[model samples]
Target chain A: MSKTKNFAVVLSAVVLVCCGALILGQKVNAAGEGKITGTVKLDGTAPHMKGIDMGKDPFCSKAHATDPGKMETYVVGSGGGLENVVLYITEGLTGPAASQTATTEPVFDQKNCMYTPHVLALDVDQKFKVTTSDQTTHNIHPLPNPMTGNIPWNQSQPPGAAPVEKSWKAPEVIPVQCNIHPWMHGWFVVVKGPYATSDSNGAYTINNVPPGSYTVTAWHEAAGTQTQKVTVAAGGSGSANFTFKAK
Target chain B: MQRNNLRKWSSVFGAAAVVAFAMPSSAQQTKYDFETRMNIESHVGNITGHAKDAKPDYRRYCVGCHGELGDGNGENFPWVDPKPRNFQLGVFKCRSTPTGTLPTDQDLFDSIGRGFDRSNMPQWSTFTKQERTDLVAWVKHFSPRWVGEKPGTPITIPPEPEVTPERIKAGREVFARVQCWKCHGVLGQGDGPSAATLTDDLGRPIAPFNFAEGARPKCGDTDKDIYRIFMTGLDGTPMPSFADNIKPDEAWDLVFYLRTLMSQHSKEKAMAKQLGLKPVDPNAPAGQQ
Candidate 1:
């Protein structure tokens, strides 16, 4: 009877220890997580955006009967806040965080003879989808910098065609254009590690970074690139702001 | 009697000459001069007018083969072999520069003047130089690739080495060594065992170039053009760069050998025609005239 009681008591103690260890491990992982937040602002007057002429394709022109499309090269907002600025950590991240893959595919859509998002960012090797929702045909030609080791591709998608899924093998800032429409242009900013594009308010956040000191970079297509040094404490956040001179 | 015969023949010749001289000169002159004048006027107009406004010329000449959207699926596509070039994709097979680069304006001009040797695309040499230039510019507008991209600089071609019998024999050895006959048939007819399985980078089935047809090669048909293709294999297709494998002199030899193949094919075709053998049209329905 004594032996049986002792066995039950020992088993309960082991279970309690295992539970404690598991909780402790999770707590430690949570504690090390940090985020980088920042805003990108233009320092001067915003340039006048030019309106697009969709006269070539009747379908595109009819689609934008109510609201005409304009050049999205520079999207400025209140307080000179900039949009389409990509912010990413260029240094101080290692292992899985540095080479992490995105679970969801980033969608790039072509509608009304224009790329929906003028600027897009994705992790290296993450699959992205290209879809067209226009009656007219569109040719997607992405010209990557040869030095980036990414092979360039040009494909044509006619109306009602299946979506094209592709990925970049290396980090690059590829310029995509539609051969059918000379004015249709966009950028595919592929990068390694955590990255985010600034919203209309010019604010961005790159979360779940391991606690450390790092160099963050903000890249605007028209205004060039700016970098800042930041440090994050355990279970806390870091801040990095960038200001660009209007061109 | 001989003198009388000569006199009779001379009189007949004189009468024939008079008849020829009396023929309506204005009608023939007007037809010929009007065509020349129109050609000159269109050429000059193209130079002054903006290239973006060249739609009329494009519609008149290129739309029948290149399509309204430059998709190479025009009304004549069914009748054309090797198909017309699709500009929307922006993948030009013929270029003096490396693969994946745009051909120079001069290259396009030369192509327009020379035309493809075997293809349905006829030489537009009758068009004034300025008109051809305008056509090139209009064609370029079909693709947005020219918006921000600069054309690739042409590769430097070395001076041609002397061609000799021994050199051609060496080229034949190189051809066999490289297994050129695998994709291109032994006679360069594009009918090798592997020709059926070739696909491009986009997974679309593509055929090997038929050299014996003497058609407009995706690359130019000049010796230098052939050499360039041999050195820098076409990208996006099954062709690969042999710059690393073949020596420069050997490439020239291969070019000479290819020229011979084309000439031999031309000779056989001529001989067959002389023998009254009608050439079979591939597009014609089987078992019918």
Candidate 2:
């Protein structure tokens, strides 16, 4: 009778320890996983964007139809919010988070003689693809600042051509343009860690940020860069807002 | 024993299948096709008149000489003299632009429209304005050097001074002072004393500009082109810039003299053609054959 009682106690202890370990493992996995969310706003009235002259290419002119394509240098949103601002953790990232590889390849598409995304952000060493959907041929040229250590490249993609896949070895803010179509321009803001571009609503969220104090930088093509410091708690959230004044 | 044999066969078949599947995927792995493929699907339902009827078809005219990839190693490369311009290197011999910079769109258009004299490149002036524009745009895709590079601003040419006998005489002196005869022989036949030893930056044997053949100068035959070449020398070759060494007026004189050399060569060639005789190679010495 005593032996049976001891066996029951031992089994219960074993079950309790196993259950505790499983729960602890789940908690450990969730630790240091936080998100940074914010809005990028414009402090002043947005500048009037100049109309693009697509007369050089008939295909481009026809694509826009009646409406003239305007310069996308500044894309302002409702409530004075600025769009396409790249917010990324510029400092204090280490270990796995600093070297994390992006699983999904970021795509930059040229459609209707314009870059679909005026601005795009991706991590360093991540595969980036440039595709053209227009009937007219487009030459995709990315001119990275020589200081960024990323070499500049140019390639032409005809209609029905496969997407050009490439990856940058270092972080850079690359200005992409088509020599054939001067008005067609865009940017590839490559970052080292988690990053996000503000949407039409001017809201952005950078998730999977390891819990730490970091200097988050907000970059706009025209307005330049703004940075802020924020601390993220374990499995918690942080915020860093930015505002740019008209030049 | 039968089971073992069956197992071995099954493994071999599995390996063979894997290899076959892998081969096609590898072949299709290029990010972009070197040759442009027609988009049949996009053009299928062309109820709209907006669809373009004329497209720049490089394959029909250029691929035979310029190569499918524009590397200048086309199928007819062996038969062509002086070879076609290799677009991959982004080095264009004919341009108003300074060295290390791309040519202006107008420069490319002129080359394509006028054609290179004495070479196999035919004048493509028959192409429509739109076709020429499209071709120019298409050719830029051959090199990555065009990316982010602004075309070199053309050097302004002062109006030509009168081309008199005295000007030509001074030009001859200027030419000799610049040692033009070192590569271009005393008669401008491209067989000077140093011609045998001349090499480009890449150590490739380079032929000096043969002025006695009436061939089109690489930078164009215009007075402005000659002046430009004098100011901004050809890059990656033995040509050195005379911008600092020579005055503008002296450069004009040199141009006048070079023109005379070209005209003299053309006159000789015309005479030979009229006589139905093989034109003599001025570079070759007598009694050499």
Local accuracy of candidate 2 as per-residue lDDT tens digits, B1-289: 6545545554555565455445533652333233322211111122211112223367888888889888888999989966777766665656666543567667777778888767798888998655665666666666654553456786566788866666666666666555565567666788765566555433456787888776777767777887877566665455644554567888898887777667454433343344443322323322221
- Docking quality tier of model 2: incorrect
In candidate 1 chain B, where is summed lDDT lowest over 10 consecutive residues?
B37-46
Q: Which residue pairs clash within candidate 1?
A: B118-B215
Candidate 1 lDDT score relative to the true structure: 0.69
Weakest lDDT window of 10 consecutive positions for candidate 2 chain B: B41-50
What TM-score fits each model? 0.46, 0.45
Top TM-score: which candidate number? 1
Model 1, range A183-231, lDDT digits (tens) per residue? 7889999988788999998999987777899999999999999999999
Clashing pairs in 2: none
Which regions of candidate 1 deviate over 4 angstroms?
Answer: A1-31, B1-289
